[model samples]
Target: MKKRQRKVRLIRAAIQLVFFIVAPALFSTAFAGVKSIFQAIAAGQPVTWNSFLDVTGALLLITVLFGRHFCGYACAFGSLGDAMYELTLFIRQKVFHKKGRHGYPEKVVRCLQKVKYILLAFILLSIFTGWYANLQGMSPWDVFSMLTARKLPNASYKIGIILLVLILIGMCTQERFFCQFLCPMGAVFALMPILPSALFKRDRSKCPAKCGLCKKRCPAHLDIDGDTPLSGECICCHACEATCPRKNIQIGQEVEELKEEAAVSKTPVKREKSAAVSK
Candidate 1:
């Protein structure tokens, strides 16, 4: 617990320094975004809507640099999902004495997991149409502001109840029911088209018995060993690498030695076949 707390504190300090102190833009990056929107409105010109570009750029910057560390380290929803996972583990171990029946086939689970990406598209469409304009009452940001300011016509008891219920359901589900099954942000990060991006790739040859322990640890339900997993389903949680006893996994650095060894192995086999043919 101390180690976890220490690591979290160090990471928090880094975030405070980089985001709050040195570059607030590093965190929000919402400066130019809000500016452009308001500027366009002031000029009475058509505003380029959809700041997904900014969000995508930020995601890529973080992903290429840190290998999905944003999800593991910074994202609020991801952090909440991880907390829920811990809660679920506790409930199963202490309260119930066993896990929920590992329901459904692996293939079915993987298939159903694709729903998140589709839902992400729906969110984008809804945003454009202002489908959630009514949700201002339910917004957490609004609630906090209202509470702090101590003035509101409707404080939204219903919204508070709804949020709590959702959070509870998310906590109790089999696996990140909210993050894995619902979060559009998560879906986007997982499905980021460009992949590998000069990051640390798995050394398939280094595994004893070529055991796929890394794949087993993946909460995003990715085959970290079988494929270069840059899918929309992958959260880059690093649970797989963390579970590796051999420390064979890496994040943003490639295993060039392994690549060279693989190349040498292939060359020797080809050379042996050539020599046999000559003989």
Candidate 2:
């Protein structure tokens, strides 16, 4: 199980690294496309297709089918947050000889998560009201994108640089701080209608009493046990599946099929034993 967990983490990390280097601007591009659509509407202009729209549309289609795998394994900003959090843990354990907490308190984190939705609404409002043009150099994602592309941000991007630094600081203190509580793009992903086939399902009957490993391991702090269908906040990271001691968690269809197969397998064995006893 430990080996399996390590393998999973390694595979995700490799994919993240590749995407971070190869297509770091994907989120920014897709978001720009969304803004453009509304900006055109506000201007009473016809919305036309473009490369940005193509990117956004493709990502939305993928999200509807596969949950937020892009956030978990492909988003450069999310990968950066994961790196910062891991670096913080390394510093605490190796340098200060102190263990890091898993995350912030669940209640506080849940409340903070709501802020992203508000941020998303404000952004859309700014775009529609034509105020977004005035705020051109204020986006931290723009700064991050510039840095990743090996280009220096101009003097106009000073505020953006500052905001990026602050977000990185937040990432060091909490895992996925920007992703869970601040990213407008993350808010959009969380609201997407993901298919059940892509969701991780837990068998409560198989879970030991009082066991909360899955919830504890979740970066989003989702209430997997209490939430019947699980929250859309799930990024499809599979941390819960990897951490379960009893291996009781599986994809929705997988859990059902496994149980059916187990029942069928036991029936044949039971029938053979009864025949031997009667003979």
Candidate 3:
């Protein structure tokens, strides 16, 4: 299982590199195409609306069907964050002899989670108000474009550099920090619940008692300890499933036992007279 997980990660890394770096370099306008559509809509321009549909519509459909697998698997910016995080861990352990990894406190993380929603709201507001440029300076996609292509924005964007540095530090210290707390794009996907069932799930019946490994490995710190899978927060990263020692976790959802429990609870309990009373 470990070997299989490793192979999956390697393949994912290759795909991210090729699609993000190689594909964009080879084809002009490959990067930031989606952003352009949003900008066009915000500006009320006579834009090639079909191109927008071609890109983001597909992603939105996939998000609805499978959850945010795009973020976990295909997003170039996500891959960059993961790389920064791993490099930070390597440096910390090898140089400082740190025995364990730590993330933001649960309280802090929860508070931070709300930020993404706020950001999403703000982005929507900007779009409706035709103020898309409000986010232009520090847009992560634009920063990625500048970094990859060695092209400067038409105007100076100091905030973009500053935000990029902060993102690197955040990723290094906390797994998927930006995705969890600040990515408006990710927020859009997360708002839409996946159809039928999430693409992956945990079997609590088979899960070992007292094993919190899945929660610890989860980038979103989702509550996988429950009787049924809680997947709204899940990013489809499979980190939790991979780290499970029992290998009980699997891809695809199972009908929750909770439904049966609910049904049983709804039936009234029968009361029988005591035999002593009858005698």
Candidate 4:
């Protein structure tokens, strides 16, 4: 509940809202622009310097430094997924009195998570094979774009609807299911080289026994007690820091301050020689 934390939450909310409401209308660019770039490269086109200034490039640079924060805070489909899942949760609780959200088995979920890599490879291969246009209809983000434009689909409409429905169901039952297991763009971000300038981190030394609140809050299901909080799957949402009851979790400069304190305390203070001993 610190002022800065509250500000961060507000900013996150505002970004999510903008993506949800204005992005489709204003930017008109689907969040899958990154995947399109890879497809273009697979087609043997020369990469241009201006390409580095596009949305995908900006997002790539951001992910390189800060992790997949864009997915958590600025993705339109991600915001929709969060809203749909929350609405489903409310309905399940109030209508069905459900206490638990169900999803694919953990083993199955892990296996499915690898499918994004396969999809990425398939897209690249299809581009090289000149079948990219035929398979592009299968993209959920393209479907998202079609839906955004309020245009009726020509052919692959049924497939698009089915995929969208499945995505909705997955979102309802599991947190960030698309980002975790299906987003090709997210796969790229997850593979990017990690920088040391990450924000979210935990002080496990200060954690109380039996406290796993951070784990419950983590949308990515990362083991927050590990040596570093900057996991490949991490979205840099800072939910762990916000949920920690012990207040041991730190982000940004707070982490540096804690390290400084630890270092200062560890430096031993030499005791002055007693006057009697000197005599």
Candidate 5:
């Protein structure tokens, strides 16, 4: 790894460690503060502006710009998945490999995923349109807090167990399952379907054969050989670029840089001369 990338990965790993340790303890308080902030802002009540933004807006800002990497790398549940995954990998390698693995019911993952998007829309609408009560009742953070605090009901607790099971399943398969599939807070970030200012664009001209290095490294199952990933399903994990033996795969600062370089290389010298004369 380059020095800068190695440093970033190390920093990300450290932050993930801290979040894993500290967040569950703080989740309830975070819930209370965020609710208060949202209520204050929605009502246009006599609330300090700093306090409102600190609670309501700052969290969203960080989550949206950074991608759900914050969840995969910084969330408490993420740590749980990571720790469990290594053990599970060992067990499965030793035992379960011969017995075909089973996936958790995708019904809940796909259908319940839609529920978060709907809930997210409602929350934003309610917050902006003076109907804060609509959202306040459905905040998943509150659900998460209540579950963690041991105040959730028997049925709810069962459902939480199912969620935990699903999370484990995701770790064995996709690295960021809850963040990718379920968390309503993550719904906001996952919907930010923009090409990264910098991205791993396959150089088709240089790459003649169906090079397989990038795809093999991607945990998300993206076919990098095909084109830029269209599903917005990527977490910007650069494992593919890292493992490319051909070294054709790289993280670019912008798509434009690759385009400009391609254009410069392909242009005829006569065209440049003509353009210079015309100028």
Candidate 6:
């Protein structure tokens, strides 16, 4: 189980690195598609198929089919957040002799998660009102995109650079800080009507009473046992599945198989107890 968990993490990290280097602008590109549609609408122009639509449509289809795996393993900003958080963990553990990670209060995190949705609404309103055009150089993502493309931002990007710095600082303090609390793209993904079969599932009956190892390990602090709407905010990182000591969380065919195995394992104990009572 440990080996499998390590392998999953390694594969996810490698995928993240590849996407970070080769397609770091994917999130921004998809967002550009959304903006173009609204801008066209605001201008009374007919929407036509373009690269922006192509990218946006494709990603939305993928999210509906496979959950938010893109956010978990391919988004460049998410990769950057992961790197920053990992560095913080290293520093805390090695230099300060403290715990490698910190868990925020669940209530606080839940409230913070709503902020991205509000931001998304604000951005859409700006675009529809033509105010987005006046808000140039104010997006942290714009600064990140420029820096990743090896371009030095100009004076026009001062606000963006400042926001980027603050976001990076937040990233160091919390795992997936941007994805969890600030990313408009993440908010869009969360609102997607993802297929239930695509979302990870947990068998609460198999979980030890009072055990919340999976929730604690989740970067989004999601409740894996259906207490929360699993498809709403899950990024499909599978952290809960990997961290479960009972191996109770899974998706697809694996879920049914785990239940069968559990049933089989209990049959003998039940028979033994029955035999002892009869004797």
| Sliding window of 10 residues with minimal summed lDDT for model 5 | 98-107
User: Across residues 125-206, which tens digit of lDDT does each residue of candidate 6 receive?
Assistant: 9988889887899988998999889999999999989999999999988889999999998898888887767877776778
- With a 3 Å backbone cut-off (N, CA, C), the pairs that clash in candidate 1 are 190-231, 190-232, 191-232
After superposing candidate 2 on the true structure, give the runs of residues whose Cα lies further than 4 Å from its correct spot. Answer: 225-230, 261-279
- In candidate 1, clashing pairs total 3
Per-residue accuracy of model 5 over 1-279 as CA lDDT, tens digit each = 455446655666677678756666333343344446566767788665554345435544554454335555656655555556555656776876744232344444445456557865666667768776543434444555565566764453554455555556766764455555555555655555444533456565555476665654454555554224333455555556665554456554444565566677768876988999999
Better of 3 and 6 by lDDT: 6
TM-score of 6: 0.92
Go through the candidates in order and give each one's C-alpha lDDT. Answer: 0.55, 0.84, 0.69, 0.68, 0.55, 0.86
Candidate 6 residue spans exceeding 4 A from truth: 226-230, 253-258, 265-279
The candidate maximizing lDDT is 6
Candidate 4 minimal-lDDT segment of 10 residues: 25-34
Q: List model 4 lDDT by residue over 1-279, tens digit each.
A: 456457766787788898777665222242345545665687677655443347667777887777677878877777777777778878988999988554566566667778877877777677777787786466666677678778766686667667877998889878778877887767777788766556556666667898777775677656663325337777777767776766667654455566676556655532233544576
* Candidate 5 structure, TM-score to reference: 0.57
Ranking by TM-score: 6, 2, 4, 3, 1, 5
Question: For model 1, how does the per-residue alpha-carbon lDDT over 1-279 read when each residue is reduced to its tens digit?
Answer: 345435644664455334333332222233234334544555577888667348656766676554566655555444545556667777677887985322234565576677767976664554555564454465432342344345552745568446645755654654555566655556655665534542445676667795766665566556653236435455555556566666566654466765676677789899999999999
Model 4 misplaced stretches (Cα beyond 4 Å): 1-11, 25-42, 49-53, 100-109, 225-230, 253-279
- For candidate 5, what is the lDDT? 0.55
What tens digits encode model 3's per-residue C-alpha lDDT throughout 71-162?
78777777778888888888889999876666887778878888988987777777768776666676655666777787766545777777
